[model samples]
Target: MNKLEIHSPNSPILLTASLHVDEARKAIASLVSDLLTESQSRNEAGSVELVTLDQAINRILAEDLLSPIDVPAADNSAMDGFAFNGDCLSSKDDIVTLKVVGTAYAGKPYEGSIGKTECIKIMTGALMPNNCDTVIPQEFTESSDSSSVTFKQNQVKRGENQRLRGEDLQSGKAAISAGRLLRPSDLGLAASLGIATLKVHRKLKVAILSSGDELRPLGQALDAGGIYDSNRHSLTGLLNRLNLEIIDCGIVRDDPASLKSAFLEAASLADVLISSGGVSVGEADFTKQIMQELGDVGFWKIAMRPGRPMAFGVLKPADPKNPDRKSLFFGLPGNPVAVMVTFYQFVRSALLQLNGANQTEPPLIQAIAQTPIRKKPGRTEFQRAILERGPDGRPTVRLTGSQGAGILRSMSEANCFVILHHDQGNIAAGDWVDVALFDGLL
Candidate 1:
């Protein structure tokens, strides 16, 4: 039963005798890296456009951003205090008093030279006066009048509480490197360096579709044995989070002609074509046949629960006019929960790479399992679980009510995926397990 058998006369045997089911069950990390490499090979040098810093959020940097001027252009005060020469302090055990020469506010400077036994009332961000090298907070000293102040010995140190020019960033230094996706902090840093516009990579275009005769689009009345198409909506929402240009191809019926037309159109329109359903071993599944005729694709039963059946390859144009057109294709399982799990585990990172993002793998944290989990040793299991803080502030997890692949509520209710690794057996209560958090992307 490991390899799908085709017994129907009308269904062509797509699985070759040389196909190895065991070899097709790749580890998730290795498979993702291979997909990213393949995608990078197809992606040419990406084009770039100039955009203001306000519009650069989530965009990939096209080149190194060098600072044209120093951050904090001049030496300023780091606190609202008295600015004075450190040499004027007597000793750590005694108190010293000095005349308040003047007051320096932000955007204003005390132009006169600072003499011995003289200090200035300097506010935060005010320019440090000439010959002044230390700052003592106003609260740390006693001010008898507007012109005189007292400071306790050793209340402040030399060059302490002073902001030096170019301390954050120096002119001509790279502020941000290429390939970085701009965030809010990155935009603020660019603004500090006087960068008004930046060059960034264009957003990736993705085309998504679903296949099956038993599936109907939302707003359409369902016939007998038909289910409303929910995969497209879920896929579209996920793609939108990545900031991709989505080309939704809608639902394609389960027939050879309709599937072929959709595949060809999607290949021509998008850089990547994603399809859910019609990938498993079923007599009515015409998607496998049409996909085989169109391009190089491999059907696999990965050693993972919740999402096992998958298809990966490239689709090329059959028309002579668009002979050079090609698009990466990913065929996901039909079940509602399986579609989401497979996309998050495998396709998310690949799409990020294709979109010119220097993507990092999401972090996995260890948590104590509050209940026992049923699992075998040969397959990895991604059970949806609710992570909570125990009385001692340690992370604990409990499985969602149902673990079936068709139960979409399991994914909706859970905050994290409790990853049971391959070669791991049934879990006992209180056993530590690795979990990947949703982090609001759900």
Candidate 2:
């Protein structure tokens, strides 16, 4: 039998007194660890598909990248200079004259060896001929004849402008590790290693659903107590960047039977299911009941601002006829900002794990405040703000006027998020705070 990994804290499911932010994060982290491990192991038949360098962007590596050959392949000139023995250079007044033996251009190398006191005109990236030890810039060398050149008075030493073979990477060394999410720079690095193709993890298949009786499809006339569904389109945009295969399940009503049928249909086709709205304990909410009926629900009310209620669980078949399969399910709250934050904070890690990508640390910076802000201690808050360089050359953060949970416009215009910890609440002007840069978004 498979091990049961659902978490059950001794305290109530919902905290009465606000929890310390660190404690809350720790709890969530523990749950995420288990979730990720299970996800990784279940995907053990993990295979990598070979893709061309052009097609490898945003794909996760499925195997360790071993360098097949040494970089540079041989010592080369780093600048357009004269390649000669570096030990021949002495004091500034000691002008050393050497016979110019040949010229070396990029992609074409001289095959002959160099004699003592002989130099060669070499261009940048040109392979240094045999017996060459240093490169002196052409400007540093004064040529009396086309056949010979003399070093001018300068404080230069041996091997000053030579790029040694394998300086960047050695043969058989690890070029990139397994589970690395490919970035633009990573692609360049792999290309430098002569890797025209890479083995990458398969993209995740996800099913998306939106729930609410008051929600109507866009371009349709809205009935009383109804609103247009925006979560579906917003989530699709996010998933597009993640390289996920999305199956839009459309909108499910608040009725139990309809939700159950939608869940069944989605679970049959997707490895993961994401539901927005209808997870809270409101009277009209049917997602939570349907989720529990189909599988186990480990609901968490993380002590964090903007996003308080989030649900995670596995979705299985409710009827006995169809059984023995389950897919991961995440129920995000209905508020736009809440959904975005919770997905970034809680679900991003899980999704990366499922994709076989390793977790990377978020970028943080210290920015001085431009104005005073009021915040209570208890939960962590990510306030959107604009960052600008002050006269002192230090970055300063100015909060967007409103800190409301539904303010998506503020998030769009912000470049950074000021992280307000649970312990300290009151902040004064000019106080320094930790800012999480929105590098991923921008």
Find the candidate with the highest lDDT and give its number. 1
* Candidate 2 positional error at 408, Å: 2.1
Q: TM-scores, in order shown? A: 0.85, 0.88
What tens-digit string does per-residue lDDT give for candidate 1 at 1-442?
1112222112223433322223432332344455456555666555578999988887788889999998778889999999999887755557878888899999979988778789998999999987998999878885546888887776777889999999988899889988787888999999877789999888778899998878888888878998999999989988876777899999888778888999889888888889998877673245666776787566666678887778776677776865655677788999999998888877776776655566545689999999899999887888999999999999999999889999998988999999998789999999999999987344
- For model 2, name the residue pairs that clash: none
Which stretches of candidate 2 lie above 4 Å from their native place? 1-47, 90-93, 139-148, 152-154, 281-286, 318-324
Candidate 2 Cα lDDT to native: 0.76
After superposition, the stretches of candidate 1 with alpha carbons farther than 4 Å from their true spots are: 1-46, 89-93, 138-145, 283-286, 319-322, 428-431
Residue-by-residue lDDT tens digits, candidate 2, 242-270: 77789999999878888899988898778
